[model samples]
Target: MNKSAHWIIYVAMLLAVLTVTVIVSLSVGEISIPFKDIFDIMADKESMEYGILAYIRIPRTLLGFAIGGSLSLAGAILQGIYRNPLVEPYTLGISGGASLGVTFAIVTGLHLLNIMFLPLAGFVGSFTTIFLVYTLSLRKGVLSVNRMLLTGVMISFIASSMMMFLMSITAVENIHGIVFWTMGSLNESNTTMIVSMIAIALISLVISYLFATPLNALRLGENKARHLGINSNITIRILFIITSLLTGVCIAVAGIIGFVGLVIPHITRLWVGSDYRILLITSFLSGSVFLIFCDIVARTIISPNELPIGVITGLIGGIAFIILLSGSRKNSRII
Candidate 1:
């Protein structure tokens, strides 16, 4: 088979897996609905099953799909821009800023007045981080990826410290709220927010594909890419903003879910090679599958007591990355 055929097959298999995962996620919850009844239950609007399927499971699954794919896509783009395997979406402090925002809202009791305030605050915080990083990294009209990375790390640390300080002075219940949110949850039932996330994820996915060639050229280093007539500066700046906004959206909507951004792209790259054409889609699909599966485990693992989705992702993503990294050590490629 030609390379095109192989890529098609890989993508098809990923879609198949994602289909199965979505089915399982919608069916496997506190009240396990049989696979066959899923559609039927969702159709019968008057039934209790309808309420659960329509209001809770479907929306949650959709949000998970969006956030998961967005995070992974952001990670892939960031790694390409920075040419670093260890770089992830959260490495830019988007999550930290969002977490700090949410913590502030919680402690100040602003979230008590409205349901949208938390997410709004989170988005604002992450946008601030993005602005700061972009502004600070600007060196005589050039975007310094090195300075951006370091500045982001420092900002992330500072944000974490501030969040901790807030947690310290807050009431016990407020502390609980902050801690739970930081651990991440898919309990968001807002259909509008869920739909927005899905739209942004798909739009970002398509937009990222437009820059695939530039990303591949970037693998040859910025100066070399410029020599090859690829405007690495413009390309990097655009992608950085796009991916940062996407990451901010994901973090704002879903709280601070880790590992999807960090691990999924790396895993998919190893599976599909470094070509951005296939790597981008595979990382998205893999991330969606992994997160929906983790959500299933988070909800069903304890049966009546759901663990945080972030916890499951951290544990599973960390272990999977470790195993892959160790095996890759035989070849001495950390990525």
Candidate 2:
């Protein structure tokens, strides 16, 4: 089939899956409301079912979708900019930085002052680490992709060690909460937070889409892009900042949900080719579907008890990463 036709079909399929997942997620909670009753509850806002759906399920689902999309889009952008298929927010240490910040807040008792303080600390940590990586990776005023990758990896290791130390020293009662936060969750999601996240995701996705042509040019190498009238340095800097902000906000809201940013972009690329315009949109939708599916599994796998969303993603992503690595090695040998 032609690429355009394939793109349409893929998007349609993703939308269908996302719709089904949302409905199933809403209906299959501990209470087990019927699917038909879900709609009826939506129709009648005064009902208790309406309250449940509106206050909890709907907001949580929307937030999950938005955060998932943001992470995937950020991953796609980073991979394109760096020309590295293996790069992701976690690889670049952004999520780790956020995790560290949240851990600090929890250990220091800043969470008691205001619920917003935790995410605020997360954002601060993310941006700070991003800047550090950027500064450290610069060589003669030019950003070196290899340097950046190495710096990010080293910084992530440092952050993880620091996080572990803090966890060890923390009160036993707070350790579970810290561990869960690192693993990620959507239990705290509400309408206001969901709306804000959606807004941020939409804006960032649009901006990233607009940079499609430049990003495509960048794939050919920096000098070539500059010869084609694209400011490679400035573009890279701007995109780096944008992706960092998107990723930081996502981690701040949902904690360090692993693998969505890494896996979803690679998955989308298989279907859509490398055109950022189409790739970005597909990644966003596919990511939304992927994470919502994962979240459903997290919620339902243990019945009344729930697993952290990160644990589910980690198990799945780790296996997928191994498969992809093996496949890539085989392809390289064949070539």
Best by lDDT: 1
lDDT of each: 0.90, 0.86
What TM-score does candidate 1 get on C-alpha atoms?
Answer: 0.97
* Model 1 segments more than 4 A misplaced: 330-334
Question: What does candidate 2 score on TM?
Answer: 0.94
RMSD of each: 1.2, 2.1
For 1-335, candidate 1 gives per-residue lDDT tens digits of 89999999999999999999999988888888888997787678899988989888998888888888889999999999999988887888888888999999999999999979998889899999999989999999999988999999999999999998998888998998888988998889887888889999999999999999999999999999999999999999999999989988887888889989889999888778899999999989888888888999999999899999999999999998788777746323746
Candidate 2 residues lying further than 4 Å off, grouped into runs, are 1-3, 328-335
lDDT of 1: 0.90
Residue pairs with clashing backbones, model 1: none
